[model samples]
Target: MEKREWKVCVTGGGSFIGSYLVNKLLQKGYIVHATLRSLKDAKTGILRGFPEAKEKLVLFEADLYSPHQFEAAIQGCDFVFHVATPLNHEPGSSQYKNTVEAALAGSKTIFMSCLRSGTVKRLIYTASVLSSSPLKEDGTAFKDFVDETCWTPLNDSLSYVYHDDHHKDYTYSKTLTEKEMLSYNNNENGCGGLEVVTIPCGLIGGDTIQSFASGSIAVCLSLITGNSETYKSLKFLESLLGKVPLVHIDDVCEAHIFCMENSSMKGRFLCASSYVSIAEIAGYYIQHYPEFNVKQEYVEGKKVDVKWGSTKLCEKGFVYKYDTKKILDDTIECARRIGYL
Candidate 1:
């Protein structure tokens, strides 16, 4: 059968990354089965505007709270992109337990659904680099650089500790979810093993299809908007990796497609286009749009340098197209179009 005739399911199809992935798959002529947590969002209607979407695309409502909810969407699909995550609640909130449970249960449910389908050859998960720590096991010092080989050390404060311990709750949740995603390899469910691949991406920037700007895009825009609270994202990322690691949402979506096409690839692939200082990012923002009066204080030396490398993805012949400037450009343009600016 031709590539265009294959069926692929993308969960969280209305999200920042999922929306782009769904559109790209459609553009490449594949029949896309996309899932959103709810069908009531008026914004998701734009998905149907894509080329040939009326005939080639289908949308389903699936949420992690309900196990087996994704069965209808995953049935007979050749590939599945598990892009939805259950971190919508604040880490310390009362719903935190439900958040964690949903992640584990939802991930297990997706894996089983794919195995039972008997048609899915690959499952690509949307992962985050925040789950990885660049430090040594003892947390005494930084490693040479973070790569696909790096794992968040066991019982590390940021890795496992939660519930009023620290503000790394979201990071910890993602760490657990990613590990659960990889644990399904060679699972003992009788069916042939399902091939799983994950892309642990950096702070994702660039355009989005949603009616509103995504959290990541909003944080980047904070540099000029004077929203100091949003700096927590940078501080958290920098403290963990020793630098700000960034990648365009477009590049991230492309890497997912790259992994799906290269069936032999396995394990986690670290996806980052630039590893730089917050000061550097501030300078670039000022250079491109000085009228915003980018704060110079953010450029002061705030941390040391520890590289987050994408050598694995690059070695797999995946090339990154957007740099820091292009990411900001696309993000700003989209934000303005959506009235977030």
Candidate 2:
């Protein structure tokens, strides 16, 4: 089938990775059905500005909590990209529970929709590195490297023990969602012959077409904009997490497209470039943009070793287009252009 004749659905098409993926799809002449939580979201305006968006892109309103809402958006699509997952950073608010519920329900809803669609041949799920096995479990760090075979240990007891840590909750949600998705796929009657491929990505950073920065990019922007409160919160969290594996936004978008086109691609693929600590990122900003008054402080703590392997992705003939340095540079440039710097 011609690329223009192929209809694909992208959930959370206005998000950091989603926006980039939507633009790429439009450029390739694919008919894209993109979903947004609301028409009022600023991201809707940003996505509408993409090239050929008016001609090839269709916007639909869908809610993560409401699975039935996705039916209209995903029906009659050739491929489904389930990229929208909720991230709750607010520990004090009840948003964490809502976020977790949304992630799980939303995934199941999308998967079931794909099964019902009949036209969807493949479903590309954008998972997180957190969904994979932990670098540290039960207060003891694992000595081995994390690969596709590793699954994050879901300990309800441990989850309650670390209830104060919001990251743990988020991680649990992703792990459960991924596990359920895979389990559903394995059930011949459940997936209806629809192929599911999960891409567990690391700390996604780099230029985004969205009006606002989110995820790791938001953390970077906090430092760039000299937001002390935000910086302190992120610094504390990063200190506990250690040097996270970094993945360029563009590289991640490319991985989505590559997975869609490559029929042989199956299972989980790690989409990350390299590892860099939060302190190292601060140091880079301080050195490059001294006027920003970027603070650099080494948090004295046992850094969790993030030695996750991405050799499987590389072996699949996928090459990273951006390194750590390039990622930082591109991010700063984009932030400046967008007046966030």
Quick one: best lDDT, which candidate? 1
Q: Write candidate 2's Cα lDDT for 1-341 as tens digits.
A: 87579999999998888889999999998999999989899888888998799899999998776667999999999999998887753335453355677788778878888888889988899988766654355635553566787666666554322234566667777888887777765785666668888998877778888766665776656766667655654554443334566788999999898888876656788788877666677777778878877655532323565665658878988889999888888888877777776
Off by over 4 Å in 1: 90-96, 154-167, 186-191
Best by TM-score: 1
Each model's C-alpha lDDT?
0.81, 0.76
lDDT per residue as tens, model 1, 185-297: 64676447578888888888888878888888887788877775567666666767778778999899899999988847668888889888878888888888888898888
TM-score of each: 0.91, 0.87
